[model samples]
Target chain A: MGPSLLLRAEGLKRQLGDRLLWSQLNLVLAAGDRLGLVAPSGAGKTLLLRALALLDPLQAGTISLQGRPPATWGLPRWRSMVLYLAQRPTAHGGTVEANLRSPWEFQELRGRGGWRYERIKGWLQALGRDPSFLAYDAERLSGGELQLLALLRALQFDPSVLLLDEPTASLDGATTAALEALLIEWLAAGQRACVFTSHDSEQIQRFATRTLELRP
Target chain B: MTPMTSGALTISDGRLALSALLILVNVGLSAALRLGLTRSLLVASLRMVVQLLLVGFVLEWLFRQDHAPLIVLVGAAMAMIAGISAVQRTRRRFAGIYLNSLLSVMASSALVTGLAVTGLIQPQPWYDPQYLIPLLGMVLGNTLNGISLGLDRFMEGLRSGRDQVETALALGATRWEACQEVVRDAIRVAMIPTINSMMVMGLVSLPGMMTGQILQGATPDAAVRYQIVILFMIASATALGVFGVVGLAYGRLTSADHQLRLDRLVG
Candidate 1:
């Protein structure tokens, strides 16, 4: 593994019951890499992302972050560094700010100096939202707004690698562009990388530096 | 039948048969109302009578035995049955559910009952079947209910709220952090019945053991003291039992790697 490699997966395999989804899959993520994943429906794209984040079990494979296996870093720390963002995000019954702040309650993230309200407000501004957006009830937010909230929630944690699964499916074009710009700015700041899937080919071409296709 | 020296009335076989005939009234009502419960009513009544009679004979024999190990064996058997019945009452199950229930029910009931028998009541020989058996039975009964309700709620909550749980996990929440709310909800639900019963215990209804003791010629004051102690023991046992079962369930449903292992759950 090179010093620039952020994550690596080797000989990954997954099977759903009696049917084989995929096997012998490999991925390498380096710093500032924006890797777009393309796969047909039922091609196990989401499962691949989940497997990379260790959210779901793998039949046979090894995933390492910064050349260290998950066992050495421990599950919580490993997941904190390599986070997954779901397509349809869920929010607890509280204000948007509460949803964003919820991740800090975990012991693994507690010592990261906690979330900065000003930094979130700044991100919200970049996403074209005002400060009062934090006060809105999270459960009552529209789908697009919820997606923004989910993005903010993950971004605030400062993860090393983000596995985004159709994060902008519900967002309109303008909001989606803002989100992409925000992500670009985020990538430029640190040795961060992202693996995302988009149904829109134009968006993928515009955003991803390179692309990987999964054939069933 | 002969009356006891304490003047407690003894029911003869003929009188007991007369009491058994009372179920005809339920059967008649069910028939008239077209409720279709007549067969079930009759079968349930018969089952209750047969089961109680068997238990009566068993208790009589058990009370006569002077061996401590035999008495302990019977208590262990009761706890085992209670444990199995607890899991059987749940709608959802996972692998190791039976073992989890057995460990929780047995440990909590035994702990509370042992403390009450040896420390508080201080019965002669400490394992006297007369005192230890009934106390253990009462504790086990209530603890079983708590474990069943707690486990059921925990599993159901996880199934229904999978999205929310996974959301938390995706954001790097630990297994306990992801599940703390459901675990709290389960424990609260399990403790509700016990708390409600305690609230209305004396005013709403005289407890069964108290009534039985009074009928057996014990003074009302002595029976009341025993009932109070029994109530306290039951509450402690139920709290501990609910905690134990919920904690065990949390372990089963989540992994050390901070993953939510919902696949381990089965209907």
Candidate 2:
């Protein structure tokens, strides 16, 4: 219940079919915290992120954002505040710009202000992408490019918490560094925090303020 | 052109048996091609013959009775059967899928048929079996196809596009917003057959109801008008039924929490 706490999970549990993946899990994220998750492959790292974002049902326990439960804020609002970025994010069958702007089409995010073109352009430039990248068909983009697009799509929404599942798995060294820098900058801007899983232990050591290990 | 006053020639039981001989042609083709469909063809043909004969006898008895309640009961039964058949045609099922199909079929068919019987045709009584039963049957048959196609397409689309749907949801979309595209595609798929049939109705082939009326000694002009009314009724009912089933599916597949409940789907 710290004043800077942005997200809290108490006694979270998850299972896939009859096999229990993890249980008695707890998380507390404070403003400007970059929490890295360490778990072996097939250990349900993605499921934990989904559970935190309310994208999947929780088998047990509670999750709250900024001292408020998901039910009180309602799903759309809660999800808007705590966004989950998947490793293989969907492109939505349109231009990259359209995919980025798609979230604004929802009434839930309308009041958050529409997508800003100049800001996206700046981010693209940082990621070594030209303005022409926006015109590229999202479905045809390479895996790394899609990951960038997905990141921008989430970043523009300015959510308080981000649950990133292997976000840089497909990116090369240079782009991964740039993405980490960009995320650091984003986290510095507000009472923001993120929990991310990285297969690369070096990247996790470099980026995370602290690490949480999930053992089977 | 002069109108012929002669009614359709009645076929005796012997002549009807003679018509059954045509199946030999299909049986011959199946045997010659080694298609191995002879047994299935014979069984299907027998079933069709028995089913039509039973329906004919039931219609005769139903028409003889002027009871409104009994006619309505028959209509409900038809809707229930149509609902079951609609679900049976889908490759996927979920809890309450049958109920969803039944409610959608029953609601749309009842609405369109009631409007047509009372508002347009205005038979001696609204539940007059001769008119109500046939009209309801036609509407229910078409609606059954529409709901089946729509539900199947919808469930499959959601299953295949699970990532896209979850992506939208994570981007702060409501359940309806996340599923709008799939729902639209499903409804469009459902409406295609109905629209295509309407497009080439008279030019491509004579409609069954119109041909039946003409065979029963009705003038072509009167039969054409009834056919036109029936066509419009079928179109309306099919559209409504597609929307009904797709809407219900949308509700079941997504939840108040804006989560995609793909776990609810049973393949």
Candidate 3:
């Protein structure tokens, strides 16, 4: 069989007020899969992404992490394994490192432990920044820089699936290229999967090995 | 003690009428500015006068009765009214909102007021109307505002900061972790006015309760001591109320799965 599935969404239906965003939707992500979602604006790309991440509730659908229902896995544990990085990344006050450190402080994450300093240092270097970047004030970071921090924050968790909602929308060409390269290396390093929703067709063509097109 | 030995003065009806003369300024200003509030001002004044008169009569009758159950009944009624007023001020709607506010009011008022009356004041009978009613009234009033302000701030914060909260949740936070910042900020905002009032009490102005005691002939020394005691009582009551209301609202707005139930809130 193909590589074992990391996450699956079956018969997913989303409704916004009287409008139906999507119905009878099915999606699957196997290990090392780079799944891209292409949709016109307001096609519920973000909603679908959030629903998979369990940030938004589905009208009538069940999301399974691995082969089991999310309820069996526990929400906090399931969420840690399937992280959602929003389009417009933001952080509370403190240094960039603090933004990364905050999640570990949660009780759910406390028992799971934290990242090694070397891995974060290596990720920063891979993103074309040095270790000193950790000292940058989170609130003072530019939009592009905040996106980088957001990506690194979730990546450090070593989730099985990464749902990126227009993750590179604010990045310049060089940063986007760097981020894409880093993500490719990360996926290759483990049996991880990634799903992205972006307007950039070129980025999709270059990055996504499989594509799901949605019509409004 | 003899009449002069009391060392207190009472206002005669004529002097009280002279005090009423202050309303003419409000009347003239309303007319001059076309504020159109003259009717409202008069109605408010009339309501205040009538309500206070009725309450005074009721209290006189209550003080004469040595029955303890009446004190409990009146205190319960006062707390119920304060709780409803607190909810009205917030202007938020949810299921069992009355119970939400009422539980907080009763818990905070009972715990703190109970402590002050039994531990400090210790009047002859535990339910002495002279001590219990006024203490309950003041504590209830201050806590009503605290809980209201706290609930309003919390609801508004969650409504606006939905994304931030969800982001934290998606990153593996429990509902408590996701909303802790908003909760703390809201409660802090709720407590600020009470804190500021405490800071400026002696310097800025004598509080109404103290001034009233002084005007009615209690010595300044005794009034100041009583004011200090009541200030502490109010502070405790407000903190307890804020704690109770925030806890309840959070419990109401979230579910066992740690979902933020924004749909539960009504416009």
Candidate 4:
């Protein structure tokens, strides 16, 4: 009967010099709620994703997870709980394996656990990718392939929240449907939630339980 | 009267002309390559020739001054120019910061060379242009390149893929932790050519320093000592200059909040 708070933003406003990007914006997400954020180009969708990931400075507002402010949660803990996947994944400019393993060197992951390289192979197989894809350079990956591989890598963290910016923009209809099913299954397995942005109305209609429009 | 011929040393007019001609050809071909770099090369060539000639005249005058302060001033100027050039090649905005780093490198480098030349090599009038100037020039030039490479890549790495950098920061990585890979990779790449040179110095090539020393009437054994010392001094100077520039430039490249100020790059 009562709403739970997984992530909450209050009175959020961002401005660059005299130009305001977003103002008086507010959002909240609870477990198992798959939300879609829709906006036109330059509506700061990507900026908002980054800001939610604690990767950008907010002009004014407070973001809280589980009722505790991010300042109190600390960056490492907050970021681990909310993994932001960009439209174009920033490949490490190296081999696929290197890109996948890049985050292991971060302070939060360092010495925490050893990578299960075999699980990576299984995930790739499940995603219709070959294990040998690991040997190829990231720069050589196709847009669709990159998004898929990046998704697999992000899942390695098992974050409670996945913030995806147009994750399937380059995917074909079949692949998009498959990915939607996969995401639904993932969210259904636990109370984890996902907030994503996309321009595909068909995919949004199929995958999103709730949609929010940020119009310019 | 031909200048006094000593030992196996003979400065032939034809040999000097040949060397000059080779340098000219190298410059010409490099400029002629239609690589959008012709203008920059021509400007750099003219600048180098004029600057070196002017330095020759100035150093000749300073060598006669017999004052320690004058010699120090000459060395300081050399260091300052090297630093400024290094900074310029790395995008040219933070001239003052890079100059300070360069001067620090030069002072340390010159101190090492000065001590060795005076104490061990015992070259009378230790500021002898024939010895001190050439050694300083070689060491400073190599170090300047290392500094430029390190600083350039460090800044570029930070500016591009800034989100990934921030991701690392958000993941509780310290400032150094966030930057460790790019910094290490830049420094390693900067040292690569130098490392290869050191490895292949004697087998694949006759180094300019040794050849110059031998041509100037020094024995092969004596020349080798100077060459070895110069090589070690260059490595020291390069590492020091690179580290110094990277550390200082990192501050200028980033904002107070430790985020890279991309606007500062173009500004």
Give interface RMSD, every candidate, in order: 1.1, 0.7, 1.2, 3.2
The fraction of reference A/B contacts recovered in model 4 reads 0.32
Give residue A62's lDDT in candidate 4 (0 to 100).
Answer: 85
As a whole number from 0 to 100, the lDDT of residue A19 in candidate 2 is 88
Q: How much is the lDDT of residue B28 in candidate 1? A: 95
Q: List fnat, each candidate.
A: 0.65, 0.82, 0.68, 0.32
Candidates' lDDT values, in order?
A: 0.90, 0.92, 0.87, 0.74
Error of 4 at B248 (Å): 4.3
lDDT for each residue of candidate 1 in A99-190, tens digit (9 for 90 to 100):
88878988888889887999998899988999999999999999989999988998888899999999899988888999999999998899
Poorest 10 consecutive residues by lDDT, candidate 4 chain B: B1-10
lDDT, candidate 4, residue A72? 72
Q: Model 2 over residues B31-98: C-alpha lDDT tens digits? A: 99999999999999999999999999999898887888888999999999999999999999999999
DockQ of 2: 0.85
Candidate 3 Cα errors over 4 Å, as ranges: A111-113, A213-216, B1-8, B32-37
Task: Place model 2 in a CAPRI quality band.
Answer: high
| Segments in model 4 whose C-alpha atoms lie over 4 Å from true places | A1-3, A15-19, A90-102, A110-141, A188-191, B1-53, B65-70, B91-134, B155-181, B200-212, B247-264
- How does candidate 1 score on lDDT? 0.90
lDDT per residue for candidate 2 within A67-94, as digits (tens), equals 9999999899898889999989888778
Order of all candidates by TM-score, from best down to worst? 2, 1, 3, 4
